[model samples]
Target: MNPGLLLPSALFSLLALLLPLLIHLARRQQQQPLDFAALRWLGSKPKPRSRFRLDDIPLLLVRLLLLALLALWLAKPVLHGAPDRRTYVAVMPGVAATTVAMQALPANARKHWLAVGFPSLDSDPPADAQPIASLLRQLDAELPSEAPLVVLATTQFDGADARLPILSRSVDWRIVAGAPPSTPMVTALAAPRLQIRSDSAHRTQAGYLHAASRAWQTPAEFTASSAAFPNNQQIVLVWFVSDPLPTTLLEWVAHGGTVILDSSHALPQSRHPVSLWQNAAGIDLLQAIAYGKGRLLRFTRPLQPAQMAELLNAEFPQHLHDALQAPGVAPIPADARTYRPQTGANAYPQAPYSLQPWLALVLALVFLSERWLATGRRGEQA
Candidate 1:
């Protein structure tokens, strides 16, 4: 490795070396003339030549060297070279540690789990679903360009992006024969049950919501109640009342129960209210605000055909259902052998190592030497 300076401009501080030279010259001893009786009577002869001589050469040299090193320290010296490269072995959660240990790995290779935090292989395996391709790209960007990577994964991998990752180096992907993660039985999603609470004045409008719920094909579980509040069984509630909502209704919304408020009702103040439903003309038909884990939705206008044309549209039921339910996450499962990373991605530059601490240590030693040479008994006797 070659030594270099980060701030070469700081070398200008070397001009301080002149201080010791000036001090030595100014402290040189002067010879005093004595008045001799016989010589004083004679006329002054030719004047002798004066020679310039420095005092305490050893002490002066130490001070000058100390100042020169101080200047080098201010320049921020560093060592320049490529970072050390080593083999990295990352085992996915489904793969057993014993299986990985049995493989003939490099003697200096590091072992870690391919999870969110990249924990050690000796610790417990991660239980939560991990974004495999995302974590792979992260590891690729972090490792040195010359470092080799070995990924041991099961045949069934999840949480992959749309395309395979392109890394700086070609990765060695190994598929271990082990039992894949257990999958739950796949079933169709259950239809959302609806509960409606309305005053007598808005009872006619409540029928519209009831028709929408029937369109969900879950009418068997649907209930229209004039009760003050709906129970936990009902996942969605239509507030057809004209009056402002009570605190209890807000509490229900905050507890993960979706509520649809009357069109005339004003939505509560929120930091960020999202538009959940929009018409073909790009007009927002419904606005929603998050309340804890749940959402509070409100129609922009009254449910009459003249005020809101969407209420009479053919797709109104589907639109209302989509607004009430959150979108489902798509599953990502693929064969590990086919998902090997490509090698065309851009490379990241490694940072140079700093030598400031070493320079500071040397500077401290030089300072102590200078102090000793300037103030010790030998220096005083000289």
Candidate 2:
């Protein structure tokens, strides 16, 4: 495995090594000249050129080694490219542990819940909704490229993404029998009612919505007023006014009342507006933006056969009905039989393990050895 440093800039601490070297050099050995020794050594030869050296060579070396290791620890080294080949089984949150136990798992395979952190299965199952496809992609990228993965999920799962995710490995997607994920489903009213609030200017436009309401062929309560807005949340409001909506109307829409606005009406403030309906030529017909629990839909063009040909189209009423309908949660069973993961997708580099703890242990050992040597020399002197 290749070793790398996380904080390479911290290596500047190595400059502190000069401190130990200076200390050993400054503590010169005491020298005493013997006055009566051999007549001052007869004739003094040229003083031998002084050679630079530090006292307590062994102690000095150990001190230098200690400082070097300390500097390395500060750099925060890591090891990469070391692949773990163990087999892993990730059980989705809703599945029972007993069901997983019945399945024939690989020998010595590690079992973990497929939630955040891949917590061990021994802990309580996560309660929060799990995004199945997203978690699978995350797990696939984190595990070693050569590691084998087995996923245990129930028939129905909540929080499914829009599309199937392509993964790096052919993950063993296994379906275990268990209770399905709990998700709130949207239920439509038995007979939808229309409440039209139009201005004198847009009376012609309100006629279009009135005609569509009658086209439902059921007893749909249709009411039109020039000024008063409906107070009932169950009624779908078709508002035909070019001016900005009043605060009361905006608040009503926010409280779960769906509104269809005129083409020339000033749009409300929204960060994300979705195109809810489009014509055969892919031209957007209606744009909708979410407001609290409700939705506000606006026609892209004036409700006239001359300007928008869709007004005369047979499918226009159905399209209008669909736009006004709120979205619902459908807990469709995941087809584990054919929902196998596709291979050949790009693989992500595994996160490197930090070498700090191991380095710290070694640093401690070296520190103890240095202290032992320094204290031993003092004991000999005493």
- Local error of candidate 2 at 39, Å? 14
Global local distance difference test of model 1:
0.73
User: Each model's TM-score?
Assistant: 0.49, 0.49
lDDT of each: 0.73, 0.73
Candidate 1's residue-wise lDDT over 1-382, tens digit each? 8889999999999999999877766655466778899897899888676545443666778889889988998999989876668899998778877799788899999899898789988898877446677688789878898888999988876545435678888888888965545322222225677777778877767777788888888752334444655556245677888777765565555444567787788764422457778998988888876543355678887777887788888899898778666442123356677778888989877667899898889889988987887687466567
Candidate 1, position 266, lDDT? 77
For residue 41, model 1's alpha carbon misses the true position, in angstroms, by 9.7
Cα lDDT tens digits, model 2, 158-222, are 54432355898888888888775454343454556787777778887777777788887643444
